[model samples]
Target: MNKRKPLDERRAEIVEAGLSVALREGVESVTVRRVAQEAGISLGTVHYCFDDKDAMLRAMGRSIAMRASEPVIAALEAGPDRRALAEATVDALLVGLKEHQEMRLLTFEFAVSGARTPVLREVAQAHLTQSIAMTREYLQRLADVAQVTWASDIDDLARMTALRIDGIELAWMVDQDDAAAREGFAVLARDVFADMRPELPAG
Candidate 1:
């Protein structure tokens, strides 16, 4: 007999399966039964993993968002200056977005689906709130690394970060122009994050 996976592991597996199904077949096809088929597990297994379709989707949305940020978060470092830090961070971010284009597109689909699908509405709302909160934390971490503080409210910066990222991902997906995306990131580093420039120690 094969050993059963742990609960958390199983849930993660199901989340991946559901994402595959959604990305492959569209969000409407992401029923528990369909995800179970994709995962080669029984429908009951999916139920055990999630109380219902909404719950499963919530898990999937959260998983996708977490993965989307991992690369950029890993790239954050103390640079010679604030601009360098911003460039490094957003460059890693652009790489991640291009690398996982499908995943990034799926988030856009979910946002639209949330408008039409009642069950997905909460998932969409939750994701926006989650993204903003997570961005807030990331901004704080970046500031800590740079030994600086934002001249503006961190919450506002977090909201701006979340919206700008969403815009960048969508624009990149449409254009598939790496050069333009990099150019935009450069601009963001200069215009947006310049607030942290004050932290450079006086010579």
Candidate 2:
């Protein structure tokens, strides 16, 4: 007799299968049948976990955001100084984008789809809020580690930085020009760090 997986494990397995399909074939192809096939289960199993494709897509979107943020959080945690923090953050993001272009494309797909679907839009917004909060905490940690005071509010700086990185990635995806984008990100990092530097006291 074939052993049955626990409900939570089965759900996670189905989500992983859906993510694989989204990453490889685009989010549009993530159907119950396709996911079930990918996960080596019956179609009813996929339906049992998700009400429909929208539910699966939302789950996949959340999973994608979490996976994408891991490297960024690690980079932020690795900072010993402001310079190191900036380098690590920028380098991790750029490297990840180059290596996981498919994941980035799926993010774009989520954004566009969310614009049309109210429920999915809420999911997308939640992901964005989570990202901003995580980034703010990371920036605060960096400041504490480096013993540097920011010229602006750390919260504002974190939000701006997060949005800027997202914009840069979106633009790079469309242009398919990594060299120019890398240079642009380097310049951006320099400017952001410069803006955060506390004004020196008069000699």
Candidate 3:
């Protein structure tokens, strides 16, 4: 009897393969056959793990979002003061972008794909909504802790914050310069939250 690959391992392998294809090429290149070839698995194995390309893309998006969000959420839960929280959030986000370059690229590509593909659009929007909500919650907590009040809408601020971060990631994807991105983010954050400039903890 032939040995069988563990289900979890197989799923992970397929996702990894899909990510590889996405990063090297683009989301447009991440076909089922390509993922199987990248994983050194049969096409049937890939299909067994994922129903279709859209399913694979959705899985990939969720995996990336979860990984990227985990550190940010953890740092927020640590209850840092406002300045520290801002710095930590920026740091975590930048690190995630650097470590998950392929995932970031895939995300951007999927955003474009979402325009033409309803399934892709739904998945992309879902992740984007989750990301925005997570960011909003963190900012609200920070505001409450700092006792800073803003007249602006909190959700709107959060959406803008998320967009700013996404813009920075998009720029870095084109030019991999951590310094530029970090500096840009710092300046932007300060300008956006100019009223609440609490001193950050010593780095």
Best candidate per lDDT, number?
1
Q: Each candidate's TM vs. the true structure?
A: 0.90, 0.76, 0.71
Cand. 2 Cα-lDDT: 0.76
Better of 1 and 3 by lDDT: 1
Give the per-residue lDDT of model 3 (tens digit) for 77-161. Answer: 5444667766876687777788777777777788888878876787678768767886787677666766676556888888888
TM-score of candidate 3 relative to the true fold: 0.71
lDDT of 2 by residue, 100-199 (tens): 7787678778777678867678656666776677667767766676667788888888899878877888899989888877877787777666765563
RMSD of each: 2.1, 3.5, 4.5
Q: Per-model C-alpha lDDT, please?
A: 0.82, 0.76, 0.77
Clashes of 3: 0
Candidate 1, residue 68: the lDDT equals: 82
- Please give the distance, in angstroms, between residue 1's alpha carbon in candidate 3 and its true position after superposition: 4.3
Summarize candidate 1's per-residue lDDT along 1-203 as a digit string, tens digits. Answer: 97999999999999999999988998778998899999999999999989988889878877877888887788775453665677688788888887788887888888898889887898788777878898898888888777777998989988987888788778988888888888777776665576774655545
What is candidate 2's CA lDDT for residue 155?
Answer: 82
User: With candidate 3 superimposed using the best TM-score fit, by how many Å does residue 104's alpha carbon deviate from the native?
Assistant: 1.3
Model 2: lowest-lDDT 10 consecutive positions: 194-203
lDDT of 3 at 203: 57
Candidates in descending TM-score order: 1, 2, 3
